[model samples]
Target chain A: MSARILLVEDDEKLGRQIVEHLTEAGLEASWLRDGGTALGLAPQNWALLILDLMLPGAHGLDVLKRWRSQCDVPVLVLSAKQDASVKVRALELGADDYMTKPFWPEELVARVQARLRRPVLARADRVECGAIALDVAARRVFVGGAEVELTKVEFELLQALAMRPGAAIARSWLVQNVLPPERDGTERTLDVHVSRLRKKLGTAGAQLTTVWGIGYKLKSEDVA
Target chain B: MRLATRLALTLLVTALPLTVGLVFLRERAARSAELDALVDYARGRMESGGREACEDAPEIFQDPPFRLPGDRRFGGPAPRDPLGLGRGPGGPGPDGPNAPAGAGGARPLRGRGPDFQQPPGRAEPAGPAAARFELWAYNPDFRSDNPAAPALEPALRAALERGAVLASGTFELPGRNGLPPRGGLQAVLRMAWTDGPCAIVLARRIDLPAEGSLLLARFGLPALLATLLVLVTLFAFLPFVRRVRALTAGVRRSAASGYVDPVGASGSDELTELGRAFDTAGAQVREQIERLERRERSLRAFVENTTHDVMLPLTVLQGHLVALERRAAANEVPDPSRVREAQEEAHYLGALLENLGAAARLEADELPIERHRMSLNRLIERAVGRQTTIARGKGVELVHALPGEEVEVEADVTLFERAVSNLVHNAVRYGREGGHVAVVLEVEGDEFVVRVLDDGPGVSDEELARLHERSYRTESARRRHPTGTGLGLSIAKEVCERHGFGFQLRRAEVGGLEAILRGPRAKPGGGNRSTA
Candidate 1:
């Protein structure tokens, strides 16, 4: 079955073009002319949400946040404003990724594919890297089948690094991914949480090795 | 005080003395005329009295007894004891020729009364005749010891005989017993009877006439002194008044006009000095105002260009990105190659926007770059490493030729990296396929030189001349490359300028473009490397 995406945009021509492109890319896109319809239809049966920041009825950021509060559907924001603050703000508001306007159609498709791929692992209910096993639905962690008590932030930080195992995840990217939507904290706060997670996980945490001048990356037992 | 007032003062000073002198001379003439009239009246009265007295009686040698109020008779003869007009008859009376009673009696006359007095009537009294008026006359003829006596008696006798009216004349008088020497005498002789030959002679000392000449002499000095005082006083006071007035006028004019006349030109004085000072102050104020105006205009131009020209292009670029993204989402997969081309365009557009924003910030003096001490050799290596893929993709050999030693510089790492990145990007874009691009760093004296030389279609002379101008891309660069913001060189230039470094673009020896950036060395006398 094709993934369903709710495409929210105010510009009629741009909306039609986006819908056509997504359909051709093998994704069923439900085009909505405003943020209101997109938000209303988001929980019904959509795989992901593609939102334009300049939207009618409700702002894209507001819609993204409201939908995020109710469900865990991935949201990808398309913004025309080139200011870095806007991109950073959209990403912080539970958006999986943000693409500035005038971006390549292929790049947008790539980001959407990446976002959709994220949930397939999520449905497995548990992920294991070396001795560490994270039970997704239960929000619990285990080291070699021995349950370990982990704080919510520490669990999220480990999960974010573990998801892209062997690839260096920049600290900024981890902060954007791991932090909760409404949590107001700096990127350094993420480092402290990572350190705490390392302590709690003990031997299982050793797989989370820091890549100097880049970021943190998790190594599987086979690579170790 | 103005020039007019000063001029008026000067005129008044000169006219004042002349006016006073004219008035003084008028008064002196009036006084002298009055004195001359009084003298004439006295002489007339004496002549008339002598004639009247002589005509009244002749041969009244017994000395007619005559009394006139305020008059004492003397000269010629003295009456007997009954009249007591002269000293006793043989004791120097007119009857005794040798006695010369008139001389003795003249002394009594001198002490008797005032010379003239205003009477009640307008008509004055005539002198008494010898017959009706008592006469005391003196004859110095018998006094042989007196030299002036002999000439005086004959002159008096001749006056008495010839005269119908005796006129006053001056003659010499001789001094007698116990009298001081007398050199001159004034005498008049008249007949007592018209028919008779009898005569009476009256004589007085001539020394008294000299007193009238002395009176005129006494007034001359004071008159001259008054004229000199007026002249001196006027001359001394006039210049001060003129100077004060001129100074006041100069101050008023300067205040009114808001500018001062140059000194010495106005007038050669202290006021001229004051004018020069004011003029200097005015010139300074004008110069400062001009400088402020120039600065304001420059600031205004900077703001206008950033807002209107720069922001418009950035907005357009963002819109283009949005359009491109929407096309790719509908995975019709129309053409994968076209999609890749569009993606590359979007990337270039983003870069262009960022560089434009950075350039604006630099022009507005708002860009903030963090400084760090980094080795130039390491910086060049990193920049080269990033550009290696692109250079190889273009089939261009990228080479870094440098010495082994470290070349440290104090700089903003990010901005400096960007600047070097732009230079390499330009080299790869314009370099001929399979051609070589070289980055060479060398230490010359106190400076570190980084030269980027590429074998490409080089810029023309005109393009090289204006290479650093914002948004000014050469025709050759535009023709050779399909993609560029035309702002790379400008941004690089701004960065180099901000860091106090010298940037130049010239024709290379390899017949391609050679760009150079020279900056002050971080260490003194430290041998640094040449990096390509």
Candidate 2:
């Protein structure tokens, strides 16, 4: 089930439209005219708080600031004030993310989905994709229920790709996060490790794909 | 002329003639005294028993007396009365029998008769002084049997009657005593003795010292003093002249550069004061010019920022409408997404107008925001509700999470709401599609913290730091969304600051951007607590 969003906004027409749009995108959204009503709601029940910086009763920044101390719900601030200082200030006040005014509806829905999807991914200690299963804590990989051996670099590469399946990771990011401190591996070296890891995986190696100019991605299931 | 030269010239001009006159007077006094001294010596010699030798003795005459050549008597030729007998009519010549032996009468005394011409008391008998002086005796009785008697005139007799006669004449002394016919200045004196009146004549050769040497001795020291005066004047004025020249050059440079560079001021003098004054004036002028330039630059930046802000929304709206028209012309219903996008652009244009105006008012320090203790939660609720439609159109969810208890804070309600609205709108606009935007308020001890977060493509760490700057779009930001007013966060920041709240932008652990705004928590007794 998609997580519910609590929307705090003052304009009724804009408020009604945002709720409708979010509902049509298959996410439940509830609207409030002011920070007073939103501040009474339980943050743990909602996946995200979509907040308008301007409100009629309580300032949106104030609500975000007050509620964040009590609960850990991710907050997304909506602001028509295009000044970056406002965005930075909101970010500093415990806002999880921000969008300037005049954003696409599709972009908004995608952001909501991204925020909802993070916890599901973060809770997993082991990731399984198609015929490959990775034990993240123990740093082990299994292909077709058979264990596969991997070097430290190769294992880290596979783990980084497995964390976000089907998503392309940038080469520079992978080089920064997955490579061992002493290895001093460049992207080219990373590619060599990936090839070696694929060879070790054997049939399961087909799931590892290069994303052209980007780095790499792992797929558990192939698309038709 | 240079000051030193001028000073030297002036001093020398005054001193030169004065020195010359002083030397001339000194020389005259010296010469007159010398002549008087010589006359006194002659008179003294004649009175000290030298008159007795001249009185009735031909021995004083020796064989021949030393005389200057070209001597002419006033009446015809002098009578040859060497023995004081004025009876002989012929002049004494070398052929005369009574002529003294070896009396050729025209030779210097050096090679002539040595024994006869020797003066009685002189030592060094054959030197420059050998023929220097000669003495002649005159018979005052005016009668003589000897043929070599000198004849006297009435003027001489008159001078003798007055006790003594002193006279100077140029004449040749006879070389009869082996003395040359030496031309000399003759000093003759007549005096009355015990026997009769006797006349003694003394003569010395006229070999005067060199005129150049005499002139130098008489004037050298004073000339030296005048030169010294010139030198002293030059030395004294040289430094003053150099300093004056430096001052002039500094002034010229000041004029050349429009009073930009400082003039050097050294020493505790009047010129130093002038230099200091010039430096002060120049500094003031430079500061004024710089201030003007700075003002001009800021004005230019203001205009550029205004133009950029105005054009962005218009361009976005135009682009959206064009795409919508294109879709409609292709025989399809205009997509709801396109309509919502155009509406969002129109909303952005409205916001841009409001924010730009508000920014102006803030800069002019005329924004009137009344502050009072108000419910911070209620303000956040109103802001979130205001941004809900845009958030929905963008498919971004707006959420507000707050404590059930009322979060009271001191603020201007209208401005506070606008600040909150801008933050939420920013999240809805920049967050990824289907990503969630949230408003959450937390209470930490005595502070109320409000945060807005979004799960979207967040900025780099470097970009995050610079995001607060007005209208600053990073490279990735410009590529992602080509249209934005770029004033939302800046206005929100202004409102929060005006309300004395702490504000910051940070990275969210939820993998997106976070904005934080903090203010003081209200007291439990419903009293306001100040944060700033």
Candidate 3:
């Protein structure tokens, strides 16, 4: 199946080249040279939309806001500016992801392919990350095949890491979001919880990996 | 306190004492003048009237008036006044030799019994009359015959002994201060009696009002003067107070506006001078703010120009790389010209990014450089290697040589490489088409010099001098590289400065610009001799 992608960009050369990249990656892509045409995009007709913020007519964010209220197409917002607030504002307006401009053209094609191939998020009773499995409704964790008992803090920490299996979560984020406020949610305490969870997972403990300077990622060696 | 009120109080404080003192002093002077006038009046009355009375009744001069045998007042409280001041020295003028004693017995009583105080133009009889002084007579022996006479006053005795015509003295009556006016003066005069030179005297007490009341009464005028003076001065200082108040408000307003407005000054006075000073200071502050704004504008322009310069080439190069990647993935040979163009753009972008990154890091100066003893030979090799593909794409032959020995210098290796790379890039980019670009690293005259030299079409002598100035570019430079950000040389200079090295540009005899980085003398290692 050919993944249909939409691109809104004003820079003629960059837009043309991005189209070539997406096409060479085996995706059917269409490009719009003006932001004004971005408003008419029907999410059902496209798998993903790559939007550029600095455009010739209507602003990219306005298009994003309008399209998002009516549709659920994944959009990757693009900008040449390195300003963080602009990125934050784009994210807040319902952009699924972002890429700062002047990136390798191959990287954009890869991001587009990855975005199209992403699994849709849905509520499920069972969650699996490599050798670890979670029974969400029962709040139970199983390593390989046998169940491993964990404390409340340890269980929450494992759940946070296993939710996004290979992506590294920042230590500060774990301290603020995953750790209970009453427990000393400092990074030092987080390390203790993670280590305890790793130990308790026993044979599949290798999947609970510590990402240095960040928090942790749960990935079994054979999963990739 | 308010300034006006404080100043008025000062006026009151200073003027009141002086006013009171002046009033008391003036009152005292007037009182003494009146006392002297009373004494003179006593002297005149004795000379004009009392002298004649004494001669007409010479028996009354005998210290006791000779009374007739049937006289009613034969032994009255007469001639026995203990302290010898007349019955009342300042009493009625009739308290003297009785007319009955003078005329009823031995002598013919004349209207001259003792009409001493008779008015100057009146032919009055020897009857009751008002007197300002007491009248008495003295014998040649300094004796008084009047019943009310003081007994032979010392002033009269002294006059008798000296044979002077007249004498006068002042005395405080013993018992008169409370019920009556205090103090009196007596005057004695020598007169021609029918028998001998008899002396007649006049005495009077000077009635002066109570000193406390006199001084208190005089106080009103000086107090009024002082009050009036304070009022006048307060009014006079009104303008001064007003100007100072306005000055305070003006300063606060100027400060509130960030000193953008000038403080107002109108009149030529101290307060105006103060206002002018504030204005000058405020103007300086405004000028500094404007200067900062100008600098910020230039900085912003620098960022915009840099962004435009770097982005266009960056976008085009990314397209080329993607095309090449796709062609390789499809197992097709990439076009050589496109490959060469991509390499050239990559070299250009890499050098520009290095220069910009170094410039930014140098400005922040947060992380101190980690300088290791590194080889300058390695630095030159990398710089030439990085630019070799771009040089080849332009048909330029790039030649580089380092000393046969390892030439080591203490430097942060990364920053030093960026500096050397920019020099090589500029030479390759701006040198004449297909011209030779040579980079040499060698020790010359105790310093290690890294040189990037190119062929003709370099900067002129005048332009070479200006190359040290930040963001300076020549006309030929603009033609060769139209999108130059003009930051490469300045960044190189900053990096060199951070390493305590010298950077210079010169026109070589070979007819091209030579960029030089002078470093410390190379240290020999591995038994290789550094070029001397």
Candidate models: Cα lDDT each: 0.57, 0.64, 0.64
lDDT of 2 by residue, A133-170 (tens): 99988988998889998888888888877777766555
Which of 1 and 2 is the better model by lDDT?
2
Interface DockQ per candidate = 0.02, 0.01, 0.01
Clashes of 2: 185
Alpha-carbon error at A131 in model 1, in Å?
Answer: 29
Candidate ranking under TM-score, highest first, comes to 2, 3, 1
* Candidate 3 lDDT by residue in tens digits, A92-185: 6778767654455655775676578664556667888778889888999987788999888888788777766665556666787788898666
The local lDDT score (0 to 100) that residue B218 gets in candidate 2 is 57
Name the DockQ score for candidate 1: 0.02
Off by over 4 Å in 2: A83-85, A119-125, A136-140, A144-153, A164-186, A199-206, A219-224, B1-532
Global local distance difference test of model 2: 0.64
Lowest lDDT block of 10, candidate 3 chain A: A211-220
lDDT of 2 by residue, B206-276 (tens): 32223245445557888988888877877877888888889878877886787775677789988899889
* Regions of model 1 farther than 4 Å from truth: A1-224, B1-279, B324-440, B444-446, B453-512, B519-532
Compose the digit string of candidate 1's lDDT tens values, residues B263-359: 1226666656666665676557556666566556545654554445545445555655555566667744445444433433444445455454555
lDDT of 3: 0.64
Tens-place lDDT digits, model 3, residues B1-532 = 9998888778878997889787778666644543444444434433443344456665443212333323323211111123222222222223343322122222322344333223211211221221233345566676555555567567656765787766666655555435453455555655544234354444444333343454345576677787788778878898889988999899899989989877788989788899999999998988888767765765564575468667877898999999999999999999887887787777677566555545545654445665655557645655666676677777887776554345777666557777887887887877766687777766665688777777748776666666666442222112324322245676677788888899988876567777789978645553222111
* lDDT (C-alpha) at residue B463 in model 3: 67
